[model samples]
Target: MQLIGLWALIAATLGPFQNVLGWSISGALVQGYDPISKTISDLAADDSPVKWIQSSFFLAGSVLTLIAAFSAKSLALPGRVALFLAGISGFGYTYFPTALVAPSPNWHVIFATIAFVLFSAWPLLSMRFDKRYHWSLRPLAAISATLVMGATTLWFLLTWLEPGQPIVGLSERVIAVMQVLWLSFVIWSQWLHQKKGAPETAPELAYGAKN
Candidate 1:
């Protein structure tokens, strides 16, 4: 869980900063290239400068995310499944790097959509009705996270479809940051709760008769 939270913070921090670094390193050739409007793939195109940063961000983040998903025993089964699919989509982003001047960009769109939806929905799906795990995933908090993420996604979609808006990059960044922060908070909250609630004695002596 700590690993997952740590990686989430690392990825979120790196995501935009890497793009800025790539932009500066690339001489910003793509005219009027709005970082928020243009996709991460733009920074990772074959002709783009500092392509490795974008590639590494997606590839490394995907690996860590997959590990986190598999090891996240605290999440419900559906949440884990959603995260696993999100990880797979993150891998797909690397496989289908979008080119600014490419004849077709649908592949990138498809993969990105998968990633966005899964990540957004995971919070809602992860809500626990049993109350035992409510410390990390209360119904109201999980629902709010899901709704906010979903709305952010809608804003991104609108920006993309409109093409005239200059907020694409900003919207994408917002989504990424929100999800990462949420994941970190959830994991940290769960870890703290577990630590506070744990028994001092060994489990072997839990139900013993005056042992």
Candidate 2:
């Protein structure tokens, strides 16, 4: 599961970069378009010479993410469920390739919105205030992580909602990068906690043990 999280982090971080690079190298994309508002499906549109590259990234990443979602024992049921849906949503690009000039596309936006909301909410939903779990899963840490993620997502939405927003791409990238980093941190902390094999006792019990 830790390995899966690591791979997911890598894919999420690099996939966008690779997609943008492929599009630029192909010279088929319009200059100065908002990458975030364009939707990832736009990168895989029929007109794009680099469609295969961007499509493959989302497809492969989604499959890997689906596997990780099911296999991660560290996450609670809610988190796993949220991740499962998010992973499935990643396939929207391939399944609903948006036409380059369409005023309104199909499933792409719907799926993306679902994935974004669930991903933003999962950290808080996954919190388990138990002595047996790692500190990352504790209420305080989980709430803090959720707040940071939620705030970034809100920023993205705020920019996206504004007319002629120039920095939507930047906001989107920030949200994606932060999600990857937070997932990595949580998984790494859980991995270390497992390795240490030190069971956490309740505060009262630990104080009694000291005497």
Candidate 3:
């Protein structure tokens, strides 16, 4: 149960985490959708001077979570690799000032999306496997993952859809709230189902691990 709380807490931290990092460095609130908007904006003002403090903050948090997911035994090799990539990408974006105001080489964004997708899916897959074959946490995992993935998807949609309009509009904020809250629940579920008695260790899918 305590472990459960730990997972939820970590998941919940992401929202305020980014907000503080962005505001501290940029001196302004960033788009909840982009999360990295403030960082990039600061760079644009100064030819994008690298914000090591803020960037490292984000990277460290992400890496810690990835480690927890691994420690929790919810992620496997593929998910770990993807997470590593995500961390690297995040670090690059935050640590290096890009000439473009927004992230360029659109493919970088795509890769990040893929990372998050895998991140969200692993838990869902683990829960399903547990519920169907092992009577584990499949249902809870699925529901939690669904909520997170849906929210993340909405984030992508809102931020990418209409650039002329604000990225952190009402719809996007709503999705961010949902993502944070539900992702917390998913983490809690992972903590709850971390063990299924004896040799039947938890699934790697929970932590975005791939076979």
Which candidate's TM-score is highest? Answer: 1
Q: Per lDDT, what order, best first? A: 1, 2, 3
Candidate 1: residue pairs that collide: 36-168, 36-169, 37-169
Candidate 3 lDDT over 93-171, as tens digits, reads 4444433555555543454455445545544544544331323335665566556665676665556445655443344
Q: How does residue 31 of candidate 1 score in lDDT?
A: 65
Task: TM-score each candidate.
Answer: 0.76, 0.74, 0.54
**Full-model lDDT for every candidate:** 0.68, 0.66, 0.46
Best by lDDT: 1
Residue 99 lDDT in model 1?
64
CA RMSD of each candidate after superposition: 5.0, 4.9, 8.2
Off by over 4 Å in 2: 1-41, 103-105, 161-163, 199-211
lDDT of 3 at 44: 26
- Residue range with the least summed lDDT across 10 consecutive positions in model 3: 37-46
- The superposed Cα distance between candidate 2 and the true structure at residue 140, in angstroms, equals 1.2
After superposition, the stretches of candidate 1 with alpha carbons farther than 4 Å from their true spots are: 1-36, 101-105, 198-211
